[model samples]
Target: MTTRFYRRTASVLLAAALAFNCAASFAYAYSAPNESDLDNHQTYRNHDGETVHSPAHSRSGEAPDGATARCRDGTWSFSRHRSGTCSRHGGVAAWR
Candidate 1:
C-alpha cells in the first residue's frame, strides 16, 4: 500500500511539473516577436526630421548624407544639415 501511494504521488508531481513547463514555454514563445514580421520594411525619415519605422525596437537603416547626428528608440532619427546632439527620447541639443 505504501509503495503504491508513493508511486501515485510521484506521478502526479511529475505531471504537474510538465504542465507548468509547457505553459511557461508557450507564454515565452507568444511574447517574443517572430523574424518573419520584419521583412520588406524600409526605414525612413519622418516629416519631423526623426526616423520612424515599423517592427518595434528595430535598429536598422542608415542616415541620409549631411546628417550631423542620429538617435534611436523604436525608430531611428537623423539630422540633416543641422549640427547638434540627437536625443533618443527628445529633440536635438548642443553636443557637449
Candidate 2:
C-alpha cells in the first residue's frame, strides 16, 4: 500500500509539473508585433549610420509608406535595418 501511494504521488507530481511547464511556455511564447504597436514613419540610423525608416504600412505590390529599399525580386522593403533587409528577396536593388 505504501509503495502504491508513493507511485501515485510521483505520477501526479510529474503530471502537474508538465502542465505548469506547458502553461509557462505558452505565457512566454513569441508573438508577432501588431501594426498599431509599431512606431510608424519614425526614422532611425542603422549599423551603417544610414537613415532608415521603420516598417509602417503592411501592403503588397507597390512601395508602401516608409519603404527603405527595393529588392531585386521587385519587392519593396520596409525594413528598419540595412543588414538582412532584403536578403531573402535576392538582396536590395535600390535604396528608397
Candidate 3:
C-alpha cells in the first residue's frame, strides 16, 4: 500500500511538471511586443539580402514619439513602396 501511494504521488508530480512546461512554452511562442512598447531600433534584411543594422533615430540623442526605427535591407526607393528585396545575408535583421 505504501509503495502504491508513493507511485501515485510521483505520477501526479510528474504530470504537474509536464503541464507547467507546456504552458510556459506556449506563452513564449505567442509573446510579442505591444504597440506601446518603444522600439528605438530595429534590424531587418536589406535589398541586397545582407543583414544590416540601422542606427536609431533620436531627437536630441533620445528616442522621441515612440517611433521605433529599425534597420531594414534594401534601399528606400521613393518612387515605389514595398518593392524592396531582402538582404543578401538572408532575412535575419537585429538591432543592437
Top candidate when judged by lDDT against the true structure: 2
RMSD of each: 16.4, 14.1, 12.3
Better of 1 and 2 by TM-score: 2
Which digits, one per residue and each the tens of the lDDT, describe model 3 over residues 1-96?
699999999999999999998765521111223223333445555454543333333334333332222234421111111232223323324322
TM-score of each prediction: 0.31, 0.37, 0.30
What's the distance in Å from true for residue 33, model 3?
9.4
lDDT of each: 0.40, 0.60, 0.37
lDDT of candidate 1 at residue 42, scale 0 to 100: 44
lDDT of 2 by residue, 14-85 (tens): 999999987655222122334443445455555656655544334444565456777786655666555677
lDDT per residue for candidate 1 within 1-96, as digits (tens), equals: 699999999999999999998765521111222334433344446444554332232333443222333343333222332323344435443211
Two-way TM-score contest, 1 vs 3, winner:
1
lDDT of 2: 0.60
**Alpha-carbon runs more than 4 Å astray in model 3:** 29-96
Candidate 2 residue spans exceeding 4 A from truth: 1-62
